[model samples]
Target: THARAHLPAAGAAAMDVAESPDLQAQLAAAVHALNHASHPSARLAANQWLLGLQRSPHAWALAVSLLASADHPSPSADLLFFAAQMLRRKIQSPDYSLPDNAAQLLDALLVAARRFCLAPPRLLTQICLALAALALRAEGGVDGLFARMPHLPDPALLELLTVLPEEVAQDESGDTGVDSATRCRFARELLMHAPAVLEFLLAQSEKPAAADGVPLHERNHRILRCLLSWVRAGCFSGAPASALAAHPLLTFAFNSLQAFFSFEVAIEVMTELVSQYQELPQAFLSKMPYIREVLLLPALANRSEKIIAGLTSLMCEVGQAAPGLVAEGSNEALSLSDALLRCVAFSSEDWEIAESTLQFWCSLAHCILGIDEQTSKRNATQELFLPVFSSLLDALLFRAQIIDIDEHCTGRVSSIPDGLVQFRLNLEELLVDICLLLGAPAYINKVCLFC
Candidate 1:
């Protein structure tokens, strides 16, 4: 009955009155014709027909329903891609309104996404894009905020600004606004299914590379980007974003350097996670065992300077965000101290790691000495100095003694040629600071003597 109700009559007269199912079938047939039709006119007709269907109410329901399903009627990546595009277009239509069962539909899409665990990147990205669009639509038409969002409480807007970019917050759209009650409905829906959604994206990045020239990891990156945008929308706030920040699978994906593309994407995702870190509570921050794992990835340990540079930058920022949180394990302070020392002594082939490490050391030193020209008052750095300075002095002295051999390796080490003399002076300066923090004689006896 539903099919018959949707079926078009043989004549063009009934095309406008066709039911949803009928239009969907016609659109599918048109997509098939476009792909397989031999004659130019036939392909052109099919293309035009498909576009016409895209603007119809039926197109949104059909595409979203198909995506919401676990069993795809067609196996073609192109078909799924087509469905994804149409879904976005339908949502973008000015006359469109939320479907009767939009929540159920959202749930179905999440289910289908998890079900299509091995779906190709093209299909996955399209699905993600469609989902992203829905996220905006769910946010009460994406532009209603300017008319009302600005006047909300500071905490509300501030939190919202935290996740979304300024451009998104300020974007102007003419679409009719969604009911205030449902403004955050889509983001909340995503929060419930975030695990599956995030899991599927991470799994895509981990898929074994195919001989095909396509950069599969890039697709994973885009989908993850979609996820980040939603997270940044600032709906679920506390737990969901924190959970993603600490997910082990994501960590593994980032550490998978064998797949260089995936590793790069993971690096980027990890770097961006810091922005959300400021909101995480101390108890939640410790759950992040992935940090140490990423820091110690054999591929990035000391081999790939570019890769390690990203991780080091994240580390510095992480420290800035959370006073002592660095890497996983029982003894985080010691682990971070050792990690930074190793990062410096046998650091990258560029000064990025060395300079970052030196800065980190200085940052740590500042915590205790706090004696810059800015203020005369300095507080003791606490017990952390013992292990940290001990490890740091050994690395710095090692760095000072190794001389030109280490100098030539990191291209950014120094500007002057054969400038080992100046390099030692710089090293002495840092050591002097460390000694001031740990007590000059005490630091030399405990650390420098050993080095």
Candidate 2:
């Protein structure tokens, strides 16, 4: 009761002692008192109080001792759960840093978690993920983080995925709930250890399926999507390519794509891959023929501007990395371009979609021309490029005249008036480059007028 009365004061005092030179002795005495306390409630209270102190050697040591003690029978599952939650909170506090005994503390916590057998699965998973987070953060940088947790066990990696959805959905209400922070922190920690995590997923994908009904193809695809999300997040956050590439997981990720050859996943995966890696594998380029036309090309030709834009950006990345991969002989590229032009030429609703479609066409033209030098000996002709360029010029002129009419009107312009302004700008720049490449002004004057 006295301890409860002075709880606030006790917490402040503990925080003060946490930073003092006599911290070790003070923490030792506290642990002894905590262990001997007649009430389990008081012991839990003391543990919480100690964790509340800003991280110091003494506080960290006491928490470790309380969590690590093997002689005691496992605490009630509720108390154990709360203890794990409190420890996780301490680990996640942005101001706290793990002390030298972090690994030892983690080992002890793992032992306790197993022995106690925490329920709902998510709780135990949170504890492991927290430990992994601490281990990664303690290493400082990305490379150093990987160095500390190299070659993660397959079972451990699987455990993370197994618990991921529960952890992610814990706060389905989406309020500022405790589980929300816990879930976010756990994800941030996983990303910190991405290399090992990525590699483990890919390795699991390669293994033959168990006798259970689950198919290997579906399993690999699931794992691939999860890893791809991590890579996308890392790239979005400006993670360095060198740090990302050094990870064995990324190598496996790329290898999986090279091996699987699914056109659907490939379109999404390849765009992000080239954007992040800034290069595509020669193996991927060589196998472009295997890409399915029905799956990708028709979608590129649809009226959905956003989808068309995304596909265009992806194609540009591929062209920049490997120019000839999308040239005439590659039926995939030709079919995709043909479909895109048809979509533009036939669409009746809006000019913006047409403009984007035209821009995509121009970009494709530039890509083909860019590859001509590389394929010069193969006799890939100017004739093959002319029809596409001619179609683009016609689209550009139509868009420009629409813009002029809208500007000259007195009242509100049509909703879709002159959607091709940006497209014209891009087309103009592309024509300049193409003319320079062809070393002739014959088509340059006509194309420059649209710009």
RMSD values for the candidates in order, in angstroms, are: 12.5, 12.9
The C-alpha lDDT values of all candidates are: 0.52, 0.49
**For candidate 2, lDDT tens digit of each residue in 62-98?**
4444445454453444444444555665555544544
lDDT of candidate 2 at residue 31, scale 0 to 100: 51
Q: Taking the tens digit of each residue's C-alpha lDDT, what string does model 1 give over 229-295? A: 5455542356565565566654554445445555555555555565565654243235234555654
Q: Which candidate is the best by TM-score?
A: 2
In model 1, which runs have C-alpha deviations exceeding 4 angstroms?
1-76, 93-118, 128-302, 305-307, 323-335, 344-362, 371-451
TM-score on alpha carbons, each prediction: 0.45, 0.47
Clashes of each: 2, 1
